[model samples]
Target: MSVIYGLLTISILVALVFLIVFIFSVKSGQYDDSYTPSVRMLFDDELVKDDSKKSSTQEQKQD
Candidate 1:
C-alpha cells in the first residue's frame, strides 16, 4: 500500500513536470511554425492554380 502511494506520487510529479515543460515550450514558441508557412505557401499547388486562373479569366474578360 505504501509502495503504491509512493509510486502514485512520483508519477503525478513526473506528469506535472512534463506538463509544465510543455506549457513553457509553447509559451516560448518552441513549436511554432515559422518556416512551414512560408515554405508551404511557396509550394502550394492549389493556390498557384487558383491565382493563374483568376488572372487568366480577368484577361479574357478584358478582351
Candidate 2:
C-alpha cells in the first residue's frame, strides 16, 4: 500500500541521515578519546598549582 511505501521511505531517510552524521563524527575525531577524558577528570589538579607556586618561589629565591 501507499502508506507502507511512505513509511519505508521515511524510515530509510532517517537512517541515512543518522549514518551520514555518524560518518562525519568519526572523520572529525569525535570518538577518538573514548576513555581518556573520563580518567582525566578523576585526576587531581593540585599538582598544576603546586608546580606554578614552586616555580615562583624558586624564582624569588634566585633573585
Candidate 3:
C-alpha cells in the first residue's frame, strides 16, 4: 500500500516535469518551423544534385 502511494507520487511528479518542459519549448519557438520540415524532403534531391554538380566542376578545374 505505502509502496503504491510512493510510486504514484513519483509518476505524477515526472508527468508534471514533462508538461512544464513541453510548455516552455512551445513558448520558445521550438515548433515555429511547422511547414519547412514537411516540405524539406521535396527539395533534398535538388540540393544533392546541385552539390554533386558543383563538386564535379571543382574537380575538373583542379585537374
Candidate 4:
C-alpha cells in the first residue's frame, strides 16, 4: 500500500541517478574507444613463439 509507493519512488530515483551518471560519462569520453574493445578479441596480444621448431633442432644436434 503506502510502503509500495515509497519503494517505487526510491527505485525510480536510483535508476534516474544511474542514467544521469552514464550520460555524463559518455559525454566526457569514457566510452570513446567504441571500436577497439569490440575487436580486441579478434587479435592476439603477442605472437606465440613456436617452441617445437627449436626443440626439434636441439634433438638433431644431440643425436
Q: What's the alpha carbon RMSD for model 3?
A: 7.5
- RMSD (CA, angstroms), candidate 1: 4.7
lDDT for model 4 comes to: 0.84
Query: Candidate 3, overall lDDT?
Result: 0.98
Position 28, candidate 3: lDDT: 98
TM-score of 1: 0.67
Off by over 4 Å in 3: 34-63
- Which candidate, 3 or 4, would have the higher lDDT against the true structure? 3
Q: Encode model 4's per-residue lDDT on 16-63: one tens digit a residue.
A: 999999999999999898898778766544323346667788999999
Give the residue spans of candidate 4 off by over 4 A: 34-63
> Tens digit of lDDT per residue, candidate 2, span 1-63?
999999999999999999999999999998897898888776657777789999999999999
Quantify all predictions' global Cα lDDT against the true fold.
Answer: 0.96, 0.92, 0.98, 0.84
Sort the candidates on lDDT, descending order. 3, 1, 2, 4
lDDT of 3 by residue, 1-63 (tens): 999999999999999999999999999999898898889989999999999999999999999
> In what order do the candidates fall by TM-score, top score first?
1, 3, 4, 2
For lDDT, the strongest prediction is 3
**Among all windows of ten consecutive residues in candidate 1, which has the lowest summed lDDT?**
34-43
Superposed Cα deviation of residue 32, candidate 3 (Å): 1.1
Residues 3-62 of candidate 1 have per-residue lDDT tens digits of 999999999999999999999999999999888888997779988899999999999999
Model 2's alpha-carbon lDDT is: 0.92
